[model samples]
Target chain A: MTSDITLILRFLSILGGGAMAGILGSLTGLGGATVLVPLLTLFYGIPIYFATGASLISTIATSAGSASGYTKHKIANIKIGVGLEIATTAGAIVGSLTIVAVHEAHASWIIYVLFGIVLLGSLIPTIQRSSSEEPLKRKPDWTTRIFQLAGEYYDTKLKKKISYEGVRWWLAEIIMFFAGVISGLLGIGSGALKVLGMDWAMNLPMKVTTTTSNFMIGITAATGSSIYWYEGYIQLFIAGATAIGVVIGAYIGSRLLLKITNKNIRWIFFSILSFLGVEMLLEGLDKAKVLVIATTIEEMISIAVAIIMISGLYLKTRRGERAVKAA
Target chain B: MNVPSKQRDIDSITSLILRVGVLSSLSLIIVGVILLFIRGSADGVSISQIASFHSTFNSSYLNPTHIVQGLIAVDPLYFITLGLWVLIFTPITVVFTSMVTFITAGNRLYIAMSLIVLFNLFFAMLAIPSLIHT
Candidate 1:
């Protein structure tokens, strides 16, 4: 009876945790896998490999959940997304193969450390450009002309149709390959990298970049997950539960996103990223025998720090608002 | 069809495909999970074991035929897995749709591009994985 109770609790918690991660993902535009993997491996004591597989499988759920909404809005550039997918899928195949080789060599530590670095690296650019809603236009290049990389979408906030064209298609494609490899390697959709490829390299509008990147993530993740599925990495119950939970969370979050302010939430997100990033790095080092400590204590300290940082930011923002009112 | 109207048609069709695929698969998964809860075991595997990190259940051995077979047995695990398979194939269907849409629209470049993308998806999902396993 006690064992059955524990089983029920474990099942529920995994689903709940996945739902929370999904909410964060919807609000922040980062793939839920980035948060979900860390939550499972670091908090729940699941092995990183299993956690990654679960996360990867759940990514497909969120991608499917959101892609239709974006498609209906006609904000996602199907042409660009489909075009870039050619490279992403190819890269994903190579990346999954590389991970298989890495697993065979027992180099799991490398993946942990690399995932940490990638998570940390993505935070800076997100912090820098979180408020910017558009990208500066650039002149069309040869690849743009050949690919016909142009799109138009209605900007609800601006109440006008915005026309945009993407340039430097080769650059976007090259970056997309790297993004795909990251997706497969880390079992994430790597939306940050995809956005950077289109928004920065191709000079597309931010809306198009985000929606198109979201559109592309489903296929990119599917490519990687097939290999992971074959390798026995995906935990069926956990993955299934997480997938269902995340879809619910994403649905709720999409509604909440409009009601909440985005600015201060970004700072909170950055804090969590930094905390998880450092924790994963330490975990990798611990596994590599470069560092040794009680894993539970380390995880507790990281969570505490993240909580303190978030509260600190909240206080600062409130104080600033009071000051403005006084003036 | 003119350029703008053609674009609208593609967008509408694509949106409908996405909605139908995602919604149907999600509902199937939810029902499967609820059924699993009532049954408490699937295909000789207990819920406690299946929920564990070290679950030994190898789904790779379960192909489409096996899934169909299990469905007749009313195995919730196979139903859940089938739902997942549908989710994976949803994007593939979208890409295939785009291929046909472009072909009919007389967009030569997009037709070629979509075909390549479709080929890549097929290669990654079926061809390469099977090759590696074999």
Candidate 2:
């Protein structure tokens, strides 16, 4: 029998993933996959393999479950999501091979580097309004549109009609290819980079780009994860616990989202991502014998403290901290 | 533009809400039935997700069957089992979506129907694909 504590912890991890997804999702205007994989693997002690598969399943669940919400709200741009998916899916296919190779090699150093890069991609550029995007190289040509791709979602927050022009289509495609390689290699969702590619290269609205990125993630992870599943890297027990947990958590998170302000979610999300980055660097240092302190005990205590504090704050928030978090 | 002066009788709306809620639950059951019929096991249906479903359901030691030989199915027992699941879960899905809809639409019937369609669509996407894959 699964211990009650383990089940609780498992539930907490899933909920935490959903909450963080909501938090970062609104912050970066992207889905939770980018933050989930590393967070699960590094902090929660879920293996990277299982983390990737579960994260992908959760992405499907999160997107599938929430697609109705976004659609009802009319914030998801089907055109943009579908259009960009061509590139993203292609990237995902490439990423599948890459992930298998790296995972098979079991190169710890490379994982550390990828983790740092993703962290850097996620953070380290707060000052820029909307984060400076790269210039679009060339627009997606006829081949892209032939698929009847391209869509638009309304940004209720901005209350402005936003349209997408896949600027620098070539550049974005290139990055997406690399992003796919990274996603495939690292078992990471690559949402952070995918968002950057869209926002910077395509010059799409941030919210639209982020939502579209969520739409794109399932297939990307699916590509890599199928290979991982085939290779027997994925642990079904861990994946199921994580997947079921994530779905419930994500469901709750969405409910809370409609009630809560986006700003509060963003701040909490940024704080968490920053901490994950620091913790990862520390872990790398410890692994390399550059750091003296072991994180096992500290990790447990930190997690416990975070749970206590967050839960306490959640209760307070429920008790009527309805003053909206600032935008 | 003035919002349309739409008023609904409370009783009528309440009945509509109840009806929609029941329909949504039934719709989910239909989906669950379809899914279970396709891929669910004769002995037991496991999640398309490989390991997690069996672990959670099996670990219970309370699974109706002692040993779920294969993936779970929509046999005669499926309804007895899933009906209980929907009995518990449908209300949650309906109520949650109803609450969300109420926040937006003042019309209760609208809220309830919206909830039904919204949730039905959501699960169908997951269930249909899952059923096929499993």
In the range A131-197, model 1's lDDT, one tens digit per residue, is 4456666777888778988778887766778888789888888999998899888888888888788
In angstroms, the error of model 1 at A244 is 0.8
**What would the per-residue lDDT of candidate 2 be over residues B1-134, giving only the tens digit for each residue?**
22112212221232243234333433443443345434533335443322242233321222323213322433423432332233223223433443453555554543543444334333323343344345
True contacts kept of each: 0.56, 0.03
lDDT, residue A77, candidate 2: 44
* Model 1 per-residue lDDT at A75: 83
Per-residue lDDT of candidate 1, residues B1-134 (tens digit)? 12377777878888787667777777777777777777888888887777778767755655655888888899888888788778788777888877877888788988888787777777877787778878
Give the best candidate by DockQ: 1
Q: Report how far residue A172 has shifted in candidate 1, in Å.
A: 0.6
Over the stretch A114-164, how does candidate 2's per-residue lDDT look in tens digits?
664566456432222232222233465653454322444444555645444
DockQ of each: 0.59, 0.05
Model 2, residue A27: what's the lDDT?
Answer: 43
What is the lDDT of every predicted structure here? Answer: 0.78, 0.48
Docking class of 1: medium
Model 1 residue runs over 4 Å out of place are A1-5, A128-130, A256-265, A300-327, B1-3
RMSD per model, one decimal: 3.8, 12.6
DockQ of 1: 0.59
What is the number of backbone collisions in each predicted candidate, taken in the order shown?
A: 0, 27
